[model samples]
Target chain A: MTEPSAKRGIAVEQAVVYGLLTALGLFAFVVALGYGLFLDEFRVGPGLVPAVVGGLITLIAGWELVATLRGQRTPHDKGLAEIVAAAAEAPPGGVSSDDDLPGGTLPSGEQAGEGTSDGVDIFGRTAAMRGRQLVIVFVALTVSVLLVPLLGFLGSFFLLSLFISAAVERRSWISATIVSFAAVAVIYLVFVVFLRVPLPAGLIGIGG
Target chain B: MLDNLVLGFSTALTPENLLWCFVGVLIGTVVGVLPGLGSTTGVAVLLPLTLSLEPVTGLIMLAGIYYGSQYGGTITSVLISTPGEASSVVTTLDGYQMARQGRAGAALAISAIGSFVAAIISLGLLVALAPPFARFALDFGPPEMLAVMILGLATIVSFAGDNRALGLLMALTGLLISTVGVEPGSGTSRFTFHSIYLLGGVPFVEVMIGLFAVGEVLYQIREGAAAPIRAGFRELLISKADLKRSAAPILRGSFLGFLFGILPGAGSTLASFMAYGIEKRVSKRGHEFGTGAIEGVAAPESANNAAANANFVPTLTLGIPGGATTAVLLGAFMINGIQPGPLLFDEQPALVWGLLASFFIGNVILLVLNLPLAPVFAQILRVPYGYMYPMILLTSLVGAYSISNSMYSVWVVLIFGIIGYFMKRLDLPMAPLVLGLVLGPLFEKALVQTSAIGDGNIGIVFTRPLALAVMALAIIQIVAPSLMARLLRRRNSSRARKADQAAEDKTEEHSHG
Candidate 1:
């Protein structure tokens, strides 16, 4: 009932996971070896637990590798398959430009599952936009963090929120701008004014 | 006991404590109603704010959040079929069906009432048992403590998921990471790699936020949004008949949950699942379980709440956290310079009694708040995921940064968030990892102390009768689940073979005729 290629693919993925785990275990073991297992006073030293833990990791990871090589399936393998399948079924190129248009009707929270019927190609879209979106979001957050020393907490947070709304959620320019500033104001009022946290003040340093 | 209760009530009744309790429950409910945000995340994110308050007040607020979130998770399960917490997953099997059948009101009301009843029952048990349990734990020395911790670890690893090996590996990884800081005994850093920031160790709170909150947001984004069902205020009330029908299951679930909750690593999620399974087997209307039976909604909801309350027994007595949220609470205890163990009951009787009294008050507040607000909270599901996720991200980032006011902590959160996403995709359990991280220092200290006490003898644990017994139990705990699974598999295979043989024989007879 199952294709050989699919089975081979799963085997390959399992091997990769096991191999990575084994590498991590070995690395931890090597690092732990730098410390003494037991001191001269016969008391357990800094590395005792780490050594034991690292050894156990290596043992378990090796077992997992052997099991996978023997054509056995693991829960990790099954979970990975599900993730891959879901990603393959998602809409291509993320949400389209038309959906991002100012007057476009946003789907209700209930219609979230009826994504396929919203007119997207099924094949060649298996590569999910999720990876791209995550990278984008991560980059935005990193930039915001870097900007905090220059722009201050309020300014950095505002810019971050605006980017998320406009670039990620693809909201209209006016709504994104309004929501971003409002959200920043609320955050500043609660975290700085009320909680009295000393948020960083950069160029537009208003509150400390 | 009477005097303790008086002291507890007087303390819990204060205006400041009461206000904080109310705030905690309110926030707990909101976060719990939002899918992908569980009590573990809620407690971790808010823990920093509590650092500024008195220890007793902070603890009361945390406890309120713990139980209130259980009640909140039921709302989403019944209304939208989306379980806001892992413990609520079983509730959705029937709760969502009830929503589809227009009995959403009855389901929601029963869940709330059941949760309230369970909380009171479990709180009674906690008060009655915790003191005695703490007294008993007073006899535990280094070796005994080590045995107990091993038993706890074994229980968690066995029950973590279908693959025991993966769970154990994750827990070991957590322990390894925990060893990165300066060793207390030797004063030498184990795996800091010469970094100054690493001397203080990996921040557990930041890891919790990253793993639970940020990781969940990423997973949700990938899954895409689903439409949540709408409910009106009229549908929030239940008939008397519904209450009558649910009473027995509620009581049964409470007892079962309390029993499970006392066990190390047997958390609310497991308790709820077990309660649902037992209800399906024992209830008169069991056959209709998955099709929106009121008893189904009542049982797991009650069980989870009871389990949440009962988790405090081990946490406050033996200093062993029952699950992830309790682990965070243990960290809170340490942050406030309060060590939770046998000594705690004697050292801080007022604090202990006050916390016990606040549980009752908090449950009452939750009942009054939830009964009228279930519909209101359900309306939160209608909020677009697009708007919600960015806020969640911001909260996680800020929560991590606020802990130590260090950008390094924020970076730790981001790194762990990616790791958590991969772990989820890989089907590795997170709770056991958290348990391992929290317990690592204690476990190592116990191990070292026991060795010194026994003059470096490795068999010191076997010399003590109680420690030996606990070690034996730990071994049994590790072996039992897998053994049972194998036995069940064999029986199922035999049954399948017999059925196939019978069908083959019937076909041959028909052909011959």
Candidate 2:
């Protein structure tokens, strides 16, 4: 009836989430307090504000956890079901409690009014795991960012473009080459040469 | 007055702005074709590329993206039932159905035509009426401004997912987040924590990229990918009848969009939502709304585009931003030593008029491009999940990094991406969260400034007639929908029970016979 591949829904899970937030808040408060210390002699220093913010975020996260554990449901949802519903967050249709269902989650490929006994897939632990696929793409992007200054905009753009088409878009080498080249040439011609917005070039950069 | 705007035809007609506008629309169209991405993010990502350009050209490009994306959003909504933004959520009802019924082509054509028609009408309205409207809005004091902000509050209930408080909580979080670096009024470092990066408050673009783009990527990765779809080109056009039926909805939505566009802070999403709601109430067969009505797509698509251009009024004339895109545009204006205000019309007549003129030109061009290229764009709907998942993640991070060039921003992008992922899983409305975060500072700025003027009088929200009226309206906007839904559910429930009983009797009679 509910999502808990690891375990059933429990207050401890909610408490743990909240407690971590509170700990974070406390850490922030300590950081802020440290900022007030001037060479070991404490006076009002710069950390006062950050301390407060971190403290607040922590507190809010904590309070939310506490509320969840107590079964005092929030105006927002936090459970696995809530996450799944929120993913696609569609309006309910044909279901008995469609209107009241907190519906935001990763859109499971369920057509409206279609659900299977296997499990409601709008969200599940599987979606959370699949999130790692995002990391590979980001890593490729970071490398591209560093390369832009090193190899020059056109050069870096070419390499990055190819990498992305192949790595991300999953195109064939020949296709990635054709598309990347075309895309870069267009960007270079329009943005760099035509429009005259200075793009990064390794040691030969302009646009100050 | 029309002539003055037409005077801008010379500057806008320059081959340069026209070309960029085309580019902008193309990029926007591409972005919109992708599911889980929308206009605001498109504008935000593109803004940096335009910083070095003349303000007007950059703004024209941004405007193109704004409306162009709405046109593109419909293509996906109809074909795949995915709404990249909340404004098009209603479109999925009829759009996907039409696709299923093999009328995908019709849905695409009608939505595009409807959007173009509405956009042109709105552009005409904007050119003819915006300046005078601005002059009137210039007179809005703190109370009146408060009223406008309060009116924005009304969106919370409609947007507030299952629990209104959650929306408020998110809004409060946004408010706090906005107040991160320096307390503008007090000049106190309220939350920076002595970090040099914190000296400047969180950048709106960075936050938007994190919340919308990155967050969406995380969610997409988790859900996995849709099965491969191979739609042939022949499957994408509408019959003449579809166009005829959608025409009235397009007109109604356009008018609604224009009116909403005229209002400060009431952005495209609200305009579309309202248009859809009205279409539902007035439809001869309102009961068919969810099951699949072309009216769903027609109404919202028209309204979003109409509201999109209309939103430019506050951004340009009053030096006030009505929504996220406008706020970014305001940044562009400030960067170029041009303050967008009443004086702007007098000082930079060419810039203003040219921008207005380009809107018309852009809409026409976009229509031409979309009508012919609908099938090509629809092909984007078929890209496999394995390819799409990794690509979405890549673009999101790169976009985030480009916004701020900082690891912390990247971290925030990841964090929010995760939050978005989890939020999607739980069924919490991300629209309200994004809206709140984007508008929170504006709301707070207005509230604080208004109260400051009232000199600690809490009743000023109601005591001031303008503020009072708007406040009351806001309250109703929030409370009314939920109440109506409750009443509707009751009616639906009772009706269903009665129908079931009648069916039971008929079954009994048939058996007896």
Candidate 3:
């Protein structure tokens, strides 16, 4: 593994990402091969598509990993940087656009250096801050999902919303509580009252 | 066609459908204005709510969001230099300049009008062509279908991002994910891993919500908040000269966008960019393009809306999605127990035509709403990300739970949300992966059928001329870009050499004199 530095961190990250994908692809291929015969009754069997897809993944991911190790930049690097820089410098008026376009991402290798730790991401958040925020949100989400079965959907999401607003977003506790309750109320109205969805009751039994 | 129109109107004009259509577009506009929440996320998060409605009504609303967001995306581009949708990115080049010059309202007005005109034009073409296209596709056998699927996958993978290999890898990964459930035809579970939840496979709708909605929310949170701009509505008026100047560009963009949109992988974003690029080349005001020319705003806005409408052609006729959002909508179709494709017209005439008809109504509603209210919608940007994102996360997870009334679906959303975030962080192209997930079972089914039809010889695909033609098209898709790049490089270098020689000749002449 390469040491983490501003200059080499992103490249190392890219390598790790592709390396993991390559490993996952191999695992899928091997597991798929273990799924039994590729053909049954002289017809296409269950493992056939999986085996093909898995093999393709391994080959492609391996190729990408090698290319990354060779310090080859993707063709999109220039386009993505220009676009992301444009998007970052401008005061963005909206949140997320659909990821269906060419300029949706930063380039993989060289461009990540430009959007490094001290740099701001496209939405203007510092890269370091983004990492922290992502971890907090992800942890909160995992906790919320686990709590859903215990605390029920409404109660757990109320706590989840509170955490996000107060902890992750750093709002006052009172504001966070209000936002959380309001959000949960809206959820209750839309899902439970209007749509008649059977949200879990758990111990709270609010929507049950 | 007239009978179909009548039936469509009868279905779409129902008060219930009209109301929901309005609601859908309204929400779509807000979604587009909000950033981070595009039509795909909007549709996926709200899809579970539509489960209780009649399929036609639900589909009408979903389709409305798909197109309505095209109209909504331009508001931010014109006012703030931030496009709410990727399709509107080109508009910002000139649109924000227009805003700086206090012509923001005029830009918004023309964009609204141009989008309306383009929508009508494209919808008319859709009504005339889709049925026949479906009829043509009806002749396709399993081999031809297989070829078409391959073409779709290849086209998307090749054009999706800078790295074709990465795009293809993501797609293959999607297909691998799709293989987790029961095997089609064999009735044997392949990767259930002894979990009851795995038996039905990774749930499609849940994954969509996770990827598009929750994942997007998380990604946006990390990006820091956008500073909202104040847009005044006092000048929300388009001059007659402005209309006249924009008319030709609007028409050109509509047709051009429709052509791009009809292709499986070429989505509205590219269409909008191409429209803007060509307009800059061909318009009389071409040089004034980035200086906030009215034609600049009109062309890309019209093109995006036109392409958004035209996307339905392939979706309805071939059951192939035109982009990621349409792919999600296609999943919505399956969720409602309706399979989309050629036979859709024959089997569900009312639903198909009614949905098409609603596009007209939705466009009309959008125009009316946007012309007077774009600035008002722009105000939505003021809502702090603090409040906005938490609500999005809650809705996404709750929506996931409502899908199956189980924690399993919620867990899937969480897992995929993380994957989606990482994929975004790594700059992976998501649409191909999404399209692959949507098309995987269909692709495999076609392959199996083709093999069976050919007595276990998949080579039968080559025997069929139509299938071979489709395969050739797929190969061309993969090969053409690199070939074109090489040609471009050679041409540029030769031109540079010629210029250098001319300069040298001039220097020698001057010295001799």
lDDT of each prediction vs. the true structure?
0.77, 0.63, 0.81
Q: What is the TM-score of chain B in candidate 1?
A: 0.93
Clashing pairs in 3: A94-B35, A95-B34, A95-B35, A95-B36, A96-B35, A96-B36
What's the interface RMS deviation of candidate 3?
A: 8.5
Candidate 2 lDDT by residue in tens digits, B369-484: 88878778878766654444434444454445444445566556656665665555454455455545545555545655665665645456677776688777777766765566
TM-score of each: 0.87, 0.76, 0.90
The parts of candidate 1 lying over 4 Å away from their true place are A1-18, A65-72, A75-127, A202-208, B232-237, B487-513
Query: Candidate 3: misplaced stretches above 4 Å?
Result: A1-7, A36-42, A75-126, B232-234, B487-513
Candidate 2 lDDT by residue in tens digits, A1-208: 2445422333454456456656766776675565452212222234533455456666677767777766674544232212222221222222223342211222322222112212323223243344444566556555765666567655665676688678655679998888777766766665656656455567645221
Model 3 TM-score (2 dp): 0.90
Q: By DockQ thresholds, what CAPRI class is model 2? A: incorrect
- For TM-score, the strongest prediction is 3
Over 4 Å off, model 2: A6-63, A71-129, A135-208, B153-162, B233-243, B259-274, B285-293, B313-349, B385-462, B497-513
Summarize candidate 3's per-residue lDDT along B20-117 as a digit string, tens digits: 99999999898877666788899998998898899999999998888889888888877766778878877777787788778888999999999999
In candidate 1, position A205 carries an lDDT of 76
Residue A39 lDDT, candidate 1, scale 0-100: 69
- Give the per-residue Cα lDDT of candidate 3 at A198: 84
Q: Chain A TM-scores, all candidates?
A: 0.62, 0.52, 0.70
